[model samples]
Target: MNEFKCKLCDKKIDATPYFEVHEWSYNEHGELLGTSIFYCDICYSKYLYKEI
Candidate 1:
């Protein structure tokens, strides 16, 4: 079984219910950054519903 800790809520998940969005670090200038951010399913939903 696939397992991971949620980067946002720190919740331990035993299975992947949704597809993960792999992101490459980038800057405002479109340059590569050093770190990457991982979002959980809940966080990703919030991200998608975020107001612009």
Candidate 2:
């Protein structure tokens, strides 16, 4: 089996239902750059609950 770790807290993710945090950057010419990070359930929930 493969192992995954949460980017926020570095927690070992051992199951499904985790979240993928994706971001994209666009240039003025409309070119795009993208990245993805993993987040565990607890960290994801806390991230969602934070005040902006």
Candidate 3:
């Protein structure tokens, strides 16, 4: 399996239930500018709970 690290906490994502947080930014004109972040379940839960 491919290994991934959570962008928030730098924890290794080696199990189930990781998260992907995505954001997009667009100029006045139509455009596609986006970014994604990975998070482990712990950090993801903290994010959802606004603790981080």
Per-model CA lDDT versus the true structure: 0.46, 0.53, 0.52
Best model per TM-score: 2
Model 2, 6: alpha-carbon shift in Å? 0.5
Reference-based TM-score, model 1: 0.35
lDDT of 2 by residue, 3-42 (tens): 6555567676666544456677786999886644444675
Q: What lDDT tens digits, residue by residue, belong to model 3 across residues 1-52?
A: 6555655676765664444666776758977666444445766632221111
| Candidate 1 overall lDDT versus native | 0.46
lDDT tens digits, residues 1-52, model 1?
Answer: 4455665566665554454444556669998645333346655531221111
Each candidate's TM vs. the true structure? 0.35, 0.38, 0.38
Residue 42 lDDT (model 3): 63
Kindly report which residue pairs in candidate 2 clash with one another: none
